[model samples]
Target: MSDAAGDRDTDRGRDRGRGGSAPFAPHEWQIAWRYMRARRREGGISVIVWYALVGIALAVGTLIVVMAVMVGFRAEFTDRILGAEGHARIYPIPVVQDDGRRVSAIDDYDALAERIAAVPGVIRAAPMIEAQVLVSRGSANSGAVVRGMRISDLQDLPYVAHPELSEGSLEDLTHGIALGEGVARELGAYVGDMITMILPGGQATPFGMAPKIKTFELVYVFRVGRADVDRSRVYMTFEAAQDYFNKGDTADQVEALMAHPDLLGSRANPTEADAALIRAAGHNRVLWTWKDANGAFLSALDVERAVMFMILSLVVVIAALNIISGLVMLVKNKGRDIGILRTMGLTQGAVMRIFFLCGAGIGTLGTAIGVGLGILFVIYIDPIFDVVNFLAGGGIWNPEIRMLTEFPAELRWQDVAASAGLALALSYGITLFPARRAARLDPVEALRYE
Candidate 1:
């Protein structure tokens, strides 16, 4: 009769494990759910459980939002940099004399540019001269980089050609120059005004050397959303630059655009496009991709991203530790129940699984809420910023400094998945110790007090 009674109890437990009208199911899940839900008399969830849920949700959501913004900023910055400069530039290796004098002109540059243009993946290659010169309008003087390129080639460049000039036209460029918007503003000059350019090289006279000075009409003004470029760069015709710099047929460098701009290299690794350009330019000449030129700045951005992620992850860790504490307290509170279940033939592994389910449920639910909220935030970030600015009664964003007038966010699925996975892993891991302790409880001792 005792054997029959034991068999009947075992069948009932198995039925409960199969999720047949059980409050939490499979048996372990049912028990976990019961612990989480408040009894009618209790009327509400435990404060600690609520804290764990809210904390995990907030941590995950914050991480997602911040990472999305960082990714967006990096993308925008990279695009602007690549747009201002081409994928790669092939320049002549400077010939240094034993006396330490450097010759900075590329020999047979026209022919070399032609060769580079013929290389696969190279869309357009043009000879250019870049020199540092002093620019003056009235009495105001600012140091600037003057880039001289063929008008036709300049027009072919999307970044240079597409800007809506606030002042004049490129068609009037003949012997005139185009100033960046910031430069125009600083010098208080406008289109049709004359600006003086002072080159370093000068003619040798009896009165020592006189700096070469020339004046050109400002034909155009452009803004590319980059402060450094807008404030410090001016463009002129290649012929005009050659005449002013006293270079006959040589160029300072060869700038090339690639068919696929995304394949451009980063600080850590060289891309196939860079390799092809190098091979085409030959070993004697120096090749610099946009990545090589901007590596330091890009590296700083990457480091900032990594550090931010690590710092934010601490929030998740703290929340997971809370899960451990909550589960440990739960094990103590349910000691009598665990003992009764063990006496009724439930396995130790089953007891462990019950607590695991509880913690995992909280993590999964919180992650879902966080991910949903994060994506919603990113989608509406611009409108939210607008509302904030309206309430603030002024523009909080400075385009000159921020390079963007609105908040940028890009929601990457991989980032979301990784964040969720991390939270879930921590939640599961922290439950193990408490769950094991509960499973190993002595049934007689636990029920004796009860």
Candidate 2:
């Protein structure tokens, strides 16, 4: 080969070497990165970043803590209700009254009870009769709901029949009524005290008001903490309630206890499920789930949590706005560099990607930092909660009575996934407009201005 050809080849090798190192050399990414670094070095921008970070941190931390608190209360209360009441209850729509005027007796109740007990998830099904009446003890008066239950049937459901009996023995329920804590307090009656009960629909005798107004001695007192329940529950023998309430040879309804309470209402159509159970029991009766009984309260809690999440999410939105401002400023500051790049060979799309990455970088970093901080706070929430309680004028740590006495936090993985996903989406969304504008810049005009 000629010397001239060799010289040309040498020039081509040098060019290839330079091009190979071009990616590592100072480029648009480096320029954008340097701008970011410079902003950090500058006290004003650094302070803004810190402020944004703090805002994001507090918002996420408080949201997680508050949500956990709400969940804690809901869970605690629901569990208590489950323990005191069965997962589902079956009852007659219109309670069979004793007019003694040709009433239809439920001869199939025994078979029904057995069938309900045979339901897939049901552990036990028992006949139940509930009567509401006014109880008086020498001028002291209180309204109470007397529940008649067979001791053998009740022994199967321990959550209700034997829940932390404060002062009464289960055996006493067989002979005499067991008074709830509030009922005992209101009637000014105690164990061994005789109380007269007046059934609301008692048959008035010729002697005036004599539908078996029997005086039953209180044998036990139970404290269940729930205001509504603690004030009214009284347990009597099934036969006793049947005789007094004229519920002869028939129960008011039947109650079923399930293995999985949460899955009680999960059936697409509960009528079908109940029908299956009734068929299994060889009786046709209506079944009511805990959801049917307490839907309003549960829905209120769900709405409250959703509102709190939306309200708290605004804090993060505002912090995300700060990222927008930071990126816009970076784009403006790097306008000349972008113009030069466009003059060379960088496509408008590539320019857009550069700005997009920067914004996304901000979001990614911020979200990561925020999540780490949130988890840390959750881990040490007990101590922080104590500090807050102390500040609120409780010595050392007064248990928080709003939901629970102690700080209870359950960090749902789904919540973490949702929060981080939202942050990324918002970050990317915030980038689009500014990135497009930066990419569409008139290189000639920008370079001329520079």
Candidate 3:
């Protein structure tokens, strides 16, 4: 037994001899890693280590998935909402009546639309009339907003003009009405069907007031992928909308699509120049961007994202506690071995690094697995959501309440890097105490006690 012990010490001496007492020496790594493995008669990596690994992996993955989903939701809502309304809307400066009331209407808007469309960075400018009306098909009736726009302008909107999403041709849009998907479903109306539209106070008669009622074929059924917009909008030609709404040769607004909506009014693009150019074209208008229309909603999403990240970090912090626990256990269990190594000429710093490697290795591996899991979740999110929805009996996503029909996830590398950095920081931080404790152990006392 004494010869065997002597031989083991001689081999350990030779292992450390090549590298001296250098920090992160190859032999130090070898000893650190070997101590983490199990042998038939000796303890190895702790149950606590395994638990810590699993916990860290789960916490990191959950945080990544939540953050990605939040980002995706924000992006989807912004795109759909902006698509439902153009990137910017041009409202005519209201004309003051002689009696002090404001009369708002854009007169000779076609020329103005053409002029606005000619502005740099402006993709398209469309004249439209929007009014509230009640729509009915047989026993079904619902309130809706009728928007009159040219077929060409409607087709210019990518969200509403998809061949897969629409059932009819754009050429027929002027000859008939277009029903949003939600509105069509609510009214049980389909393409080629006639639906009555009643505009209150649309006409004045001897009976004091009369609603202008008309029917037109439902030549188009389309979706903008926004629940509220689809539920509330109906479309017709600019001429029919003007005639029906009694706005003689005028439009309620001119909506413009911009090539870079996010850069609008921002320092990069400075849409003030665009505004100046539009004004130079001889139009008196009040402008509002998509950000103005949905600022509050987007702000709420930002707040939620920040709060969730903070809350989920607690999970990682708690998991990191497990690292401390496992390291403490490991240091305690390896006291005899540590004493033998120290007596064999291993430096205190070397001992510290060995144990640090143990805890940090587990953390590093766990974080890697978590990141891989997060990426896979984002890539296969649709099928995963469908499976979850199926198991939940289709209660996962409701378009009416959530405003979007499907679950979404957008994995950003920045988010992934942030998550990885957080895990590593916490891991390295918690690991130091126990590693230092192991380093400071007195070889004589350790060997004597054991």
**Best model per TM-score:** 3
Model 1 residue 257 CA deviation in Å: 1.1
Candidate 1's TM-score reads 0.85
**Candidates' TM-scores?**
0.85, 0.75, 0.90
What ranges in model 2 sit over 4 Å off?
1-33, 38-41, 93-108, 136-140, 155-158, 161-165, 185-196, 201-204, 211-220, 223-225, 262-271, 281-284, 303-315, 334-357, 373-409, 435-450
Q: What is candidate 2's TM-score against the reference?
A: 0.75
What is candidate 3's CA lDDT for residue 204? Answer: 90
Steric clash pairs (candidate 3):
none
Tens digits of lDDT, candidate 1, 1-450: 685465456656765775544433366777788888856543333666777888899889988999999988888777777777677888777889899979889868888889899988888999999999999998999899999998888887665777634578887888699998888999999999999999865555688877899999999898776777888989999988888887777899999988787687854587777677778888678777877877787778789988898898899989877777777778888899998997876766677788888778887887788888888888899888799888999668776787653466888999888788888888888878888888777778899978
Off by over 4 Å in 1: 1-28, 39-45, 95-102, 164-166, 203-206, 261-272, 343-345, 385-407
State the C-alpha lDDT per candidate: 0.81, 0.71, 0.83
- RMSD, every candidate, angstroms: 4.5, 7.0, 5.2
Lowest-sum lDDT 10-residue window in model 2: 397-406
lDDT of 3 by residue, 371-404 (tens): 8888888889899988988999987688889888
The digit string of per-residue lDDT tens for model 2 on 300-370 reads: 98899889889878877887777677777667767897889777666565677777776777777778877
Report the lDDT of model 1 for residue 46: 65
Q: lDDT of candidate 3 vs native?
A: 0.83
